[model samples]
Each structure stands twice: as C-alpha cells, then as structure tokens.
Target chain A: MSNRREIEREAEHVLRELSKHLEEIELEETYHVIDAESLRADSSPELRRGFREAALSIAPRRDGAHYVAEAGTWV
Target chain B: MSRQALGEAEENLARRFEEIERRDREINSFIELNPHAQEEARRAEKLGGRLAGMTVAVKSNINVRGLRATCASKTLENYVAPYDAVVVERLRREGAVILGMTNMDEFACGSSGESSYFGPTENPSAKGRIPGGSSSGSAAAVAAGFADAALGSDTGGSIRNPASHCGVVGVKPTYGLVPRHGLIDLAMSLDQIGPIARDVRTAALLLEVIAGSSREASMLDVEPQPYSQRLSADLSGIKVGFAKEYEEVTSPEILGVVKRALRRLEAQGAELVEVELPNLEKALPTYYLIVFVEFFSATRRYDGRRYGYRIEEVCGEEVLRRIMLGSYISQKEYAGRYYRRALQFRSLIRRELLQALEEVDVLAGPTTPKLPHRLGERLTPLEMYAYDLLTVPANLAGIPAGVVPAGRVNGIPVGLQVQAKPLQEQVMLNVMLAAEGRA
Candidate 1:
C-alpha cells in the first residue's frame, strides 16, 4: 500500500488535471449552500428489528457480538 | 369473491414464473428467483388491494429479505438482504408477490447494463440491442411479460432509460417522494425508487403504493394522493412544453418519433408551447459531478469485513472509474471548485425546470438521445453517460418524470419523457396516460 505522502502526491496530480477541465466551463451562478434537512433516525422497536436482521445477513466474519477484522501492522 | 380472485392470480403468477424460466435464459432479466414466490402468491391470493396477485420484480439494489441484494456486482454476489426495503414492505403489505431480484448495472453505475456481473439484460423489444440501464432487468422483465410491474431506482435515468428501450412505462418520482430507507443508493440525493411496467396505470398504481411518507423519516412528508385514481385519457386544454434544447441533442430518428408524439398530443386537443431550457447542455456535467461524489461516499461501506468484498478490488470498470473521478473531484482542495460548483448549478437547473413547469402542465422530450446500441459494443464512459442526458435534468431538479412508449425507430421502442413539478405526479401520469392512449 502507498504511504500517506505518496497518496497525497497522487491526489494533488489528479486535482490539478481535473481542475483544469472544470475551469473551461464558465459558471454564472454564485455560490450558495442549499439547505438539506437533517435525517431523523428512528430508534423504534421495528427499526431495531430491521437493523438486527441486517446485521445477521452481513457476510460472516463476525463473532456473536462483534465483527472480526484483519489485524493491522504498525510501523 | 376474494378466493376466486386469488385463484386467478395464482394461475397468472405460475404462468409468469414458467415464462421467466423459459425465456429469461435469453433475456437475463433476473439474478435470483424468490424461492418463496409461489408461497407468497398463495398468501397474496388472500390479500385485498390494488396490486393483489401482481408479480413485482425488484431491482437487486433494493432490499428484499431472503434475496441477494447484489446491485449486480460481484462484491455483493452472495449478500442476501436481511430486511425488506420500505417500498418492498409496502408492496408486500398490499398483496404484490416479490417475483425475483432483477439485474442492474453494478452499484447502479453504468447506463448500458453491460456493466452487470450477472450479464447484460437483453432488450426484449429489440432482439440484439442493449436494454438501456441501470434498471435494465426491471424494464425488460415488464416488457417480456415476466412481471406485471417491477421497481427500479432512478438516480440518473436508470428506470426511464431501460423503459424507453424496452417499450415499457417507467416513473422516476420526484426525489425524496419515495422513502430510501433500504435502497442501496447510487447517489443519495438523486436516487428515487420508481415503477416500470407495461402500461401507465400499472406504473402509477405501483408508484402510489410505494411513494409518500413512511415510518422512516426519509420521505418528503407530502400526503400521498391517489395517483392511479387520477389518471385520465383526456388531454383537452392541457399545455405540454416541448424543450428546444432537447431537440438539439436528440438523434434524428429519435426526434422523429418524439415529434410525432407531440403532434398526436396536439391532435388530441392539447396545446403545445415551445419552452427554453438554456442550461440543458450543462445538466449532464452537473449531474455527474454530484453523482460521482455521492456515489464515492456511498461505496465507502463496502469494506470486505462487513459486506461481501472490498469494492475497489471487485467492482466493474465503470464503477471504479466513477469512484476515482468522484474521489478526485471531492478532494478538499478541489471540493469547492468541482463539487460545490456542481451543487450550485443543480440549483440553476432546478430553477429552470420549476419555471418551465409553471407554464406547461408537463414537459415532453425523448427519453434518450439515441437508440441503444448492440451489447458488447465498446463505448467510452462519456458515451455511456450520454444515454442519460435527457433524463438527468429531472433527477437534478427533483421533479416528477415518467416515460411512455411513444413510437418506434427501426423497430426498437423509443419513449417520450414527461415531466411535471414536484408532487405533481398526477399531471405527469395523466400526460403519460394520454400518450399511451395515442400509442
């Protein structure tokens, strides 16, 4: 895997090229943030049942209570 | 009386399943058959509702408990849904039997259905041409008579594109009109699950059942209207707007059919008005810039530990390309330049559509710029994105849009897209009903 520095460098290169392409289009609209409604999560029993069902269907690499993950290597 | 109706529906359901078994090898519309469909049909026979005994094929991206919700990607090829999507629950509650999971573009990314890991769906209307996608199978299932109707998500023309090619009716309901609680979203802001069926009434009926406020707070909170009840064949004094900008981009063959459709509406006593949509050229760019970013964000959940496989390693080329482009566009440095600008432009497109709808009851245009090409034909990603050019504006604007079989070009079906203001699905469907009558 690429290190942080390498990933940042690649990202910079991509932004440079992409920005140039976007610059060709002249935008007439001024910047303004459109207000989107905040999502309200339901904690009802039905929703809990749905979540439990989804967790059960997730591809198995999990313990009964928690998902198992690959151990990370540290430098 | 209900028992007799149930018996008839069971017969119809059995016949449809058998037909799917025989012809689906060639069509490839379905990914997995609901093993409990016959059992569900037997149960549906006892239920009473508008959709009682109807076979509804759901696109694989939408969750149906005990069925693989793959989104036609190898990444989730074995991932069975544990819960029904809000729309699926509503449909089942109303007595519709879930027939199977239909194929779609992997992660709902590609327009040409060929990006599906399950294989591209064949257009039943045109022998060798592509079933326009990413709702390719849902449209094909209805067109092929495998289902009475099917539900497909429309982010940017996923439902209408295939509906046009497969000669079926498809609706991309106003954004947020249908709850998205269980939809495997392509782009959260743009995705709305709608119905594809052989006729306008069935599409409208399914839309009525699936749309409106749900237990989840994701819907628009608008009081649902009886959309199917309001559909009318009458078009007297109804004003239909024909956008000149749509004409500039559409192919000559496709334009020929749409023009005939406009004339038919005129002959039916509907007044036609020429509307200017100056920002049509910019819509495609604006649509993709937002979708790419939103899609990228949505796919972050596909890490192998939780889902089937890590998306980056297993996704199709089109999906990978979107993720990369989205990642590039969403960089902190470039977010204002690309992503923010696209969002601002979205407002402009929405404003233009809202203004146009104030003048006309509905806006009519060709659903796709060109007819679908043959499967396996190589196209640049830009070419594939162009398939949604006409249909994306509605998604961008969060307006109600529907497609009806207008006419055919070279024996392949072409659709006339109709659009109305948000929450005005009745007007859009009435226009579609009139158009279907003309056909």
Candidate 2:
C-alpha cells in the first residue's frame, strides 16, 4: 500500500476506536436543535457598517466593493 | 479622590506597563500590548465605573477594535479586529483598560499553550511546564500580575484548564448567558467568553458586565445579575456533588488536592453528595466531534481570498487534523455514524448532568484530569485530548462552572472546579469563594 493510504487506514482505526467508547451512550428523544430564526435578527445600521468596514479592511485582496478570492484549491 | 491620588494611580499604571513589557519578554503571554493603554488607563481612572482602575488582557480570539485578533494562527497573522467584541465593549463602557491581546493555541485547538504561531506561553506558576490552553496567555497574564483580570473564551475548558494550571480564577458562564458577538468561533454551541482573574470577586464583576442581553448577538433570555455583590463565602446548607467518574479519571496528586479543598468547603458547612453521571465518560468524544464539525464550518470563511490565508494551508498540525476529520465525517456517507451520533450523545450527557444537578446544588471535581505536562513534552494527540476530560461536561450541559485555587501539588497549582445548573452562577461563585478561603 502507498504510505498515504497506510496513514489513512491508521487514522480510520483510531477514529473507530474513539467512537467505540461512545457506542453504549443511548440516544433518547433529544436532538441537537438550534433556533435559526432567533439567530437572524438584524443589527443597527451603524453597528453593521462598523462590522462591514472592519471585515473589509482585513481582506488581503479587494476589488472595488468585492473581495477577490482564488477560484481553485491551492492544495 | 484627590489630585495627588489620581497622579499616584497614573504613576502606578506606568510602572505596571513597564513590568508587563519586561516580564512578558520571557513569559511570552502577550501577543501585542495596547499602544493606547496609558491613555485609556487615564480615561478609565477619570470615568470611574464598576471596573475602573482594572487592567484586562484579552485572549487573541476575542476582538478588541484596532488590535489584531490573530487567534494565534498564521492564517490571521495580520487580521486586525474591525470592532470591539461585545464583551470588550462592555468592559470599555464600565471603565476597564484594555491592556492588549494575549497568545493562545493556534485557533484554540491545543491543550497546551505551545502551538501558537507567535510562540508558546510559559506557565508563570509552574516553571518549565505548559500553561494550559487555549486561554493560556489570559490565565498567565493574571498569574504574572501583568493584568488585574483577563477575558478568555472557554469552549471545553479553555479558561478553566489554564486557570487550574496557573492558579487563577476562571469562569465559564452558562451558554448564551454571555453574548458571543465579537468572539471568533471555535464551536459556537459550546464556546463562552468568560473572565479569568486572581480572585473570584473580580471574575464575578467581569462576568456581570459581559453577561447580559445584547443587540449584537443572540443571548440567553435570562437577565444578568449583579454577581459580584451576590458572592459570599458562606456555603451553609449548600450540597456539593462529586461524581465517581471525575474522581476515577483525575490523577492521584491533583485529586488529593481537590478533595482537601472540598473538605475546606465542608468545614464551612457545605454537605457533600455523590452524584452518578453514567454518560460522563462519553463527554470527551462528544465534545470533539461537535467541535470538529462546528470548527470546520466556522473556518470556511478563511478561504485565502477574502481575509487571511487558507486555514488548511496555514494552520498547525492539530488544526489540520480536525479539519480533515470534520470534512470526512461531514460527508453524506459518514455523517450519521459520527457527527449525528455525537450530537445525540451530547444531549445524553446534558441530560445526565441536569439530572445530577437536580439532586445537588453544585458539583465539585479536579479541573483537569491530570497535572499539566512539562513544556516540550512529546504527548500524543490522545494525551492532549485527555486534558479536557473533566472540563468538557459543563460546556456540554450549558452550565456555569469555575475553578478556584485548591492548593499546590509539588508546588504546581491544582484547581477545585465547582459547577451549578444553567444560569445559577451566583451559587457556583459562592462555592468558589468558599474554596478561596474567603469563608
């Protein structure tokens, strides 16, 4: 097997072992639910603008009003 | 109160700045000292609110306008915060001087403070050992007296772990009790921006200011209380719970310190109770699974085009591991077996804790399962993950938890952790105050 493939297999084995310990934890009626609507409230325009400017100022590459992003994966 | 007193305060503040600069050269606790700190301290002295005359160092993950919120990663090496995080704003409003940003594990991923792109933060209390992380520098700054108090975000023991190892006070408020507006996310569901201080009262004051309803972010519906005023050393009639699971996992030396501290509480009239949390052992896996998924989702914005470097390209080994694991688990093929299962287990752990709390007023345990490993120790990933074993359950349960200096083992600090039900911070603080010998 390729070295990369061997490492991948090892990782899988480790993850499997970790998951095995949690297997006996029986899931009851509960689900991890988040309220999407409550998280959607609008901020004041002044606050929004301040956040926008701060975010925009840090962008490494900017074109006019848009942040220019690389199109393909570098890795 | 007088002109001479004000002048003296200013003189003291200048000396503190000099001390921080000189000492931090060796400790590496601070990432950047606030250039405007002197002016801000002068202003705070004049303004005189609840936190006036207090100097606060913020963890790098929490934003302070005009300072770099690097999260100690090369990905955000140059990313300056555009605005104050809600907690920072609250502190500024109440006349607290923002000292500067402190270092942390790269993207808050490591148990030890050694993974920062800037450099590792040496433990101030335990020389030649790691300051527990990712709130490493926050706790260290307080330990080294560089700041009166500091702000650190706890996802799973980030604040409390360092607080324990460094012999300071750290509080992780019940989830949503503190607003998360300015914090860069590690795991939003579990992350809480909280206070680290030399004493419980200062931590309570910081928590009071930062924990409230905010227009900028979704917060818990509960009203913030005057936690500082509510603190008392009296633990009379309070039932302190201990889980066998916690005792089972903690190292003998640290556990001995924690038990003796619990006896101190008992001396002050608190009753001890044994509580069963059958699902406690499963919390670590549950926490990491949830963290991995949420962290991967949160890092999608750092795609190299918009802000910082692509995270996967610039992040440390631990970070890359989580991102890859999260990506793999999130795939349609494996999501159910891992991520979904983890969520369900999270709920089980939460239920177990809530049930345990119903039988007792608070739970006590060692903050971390073991003493901090020596700096530069070659620890496996599992060894690093073990540090969160005792700390993660509170985050999972969305409860208030804190660490108080229990005593020392071999001159290394050990913390006695006290946890209370959701939104019951005052009760937890009282127990911690008793642990601090204020009783």
Error of 1 at B90 (Å): 0.7
lDDT tens per residue, model 2, B109-155: 98899999999999999999999999999999999999889999999
- The residue pairs in collision within model 2 are none
Q: How do the residues B1-439 of candidate 1 rate in per-residue lDDT, one tens digit apiece?
A: 2657767887988899899989999999999999999888888888767788999999999999999999999899999999999999999999999999999989998888888998889989999999999999999999999999999999999999999999999999988889998899899999999999898988888988988898774667877778888888788989999999887899999999999999998888789999999879778878888887899999999989899799988877777777777877777635388888778788888999999989999999899999999989988666777898899999999998999999998799999999999888998898898889566
The CAPRI quality class of candidate 2 comes to: incorrect
lDDT (CA) per prediction: 0.88, 0.88
- Scoring each candidate complex against the real one, what DockQ results? 0.08, 0.18
Error of 2 at B106 (Å): 0.6
RMSD of 2: 8.5
Worst 10 residues of 1 chain B by lDDT: B326-335
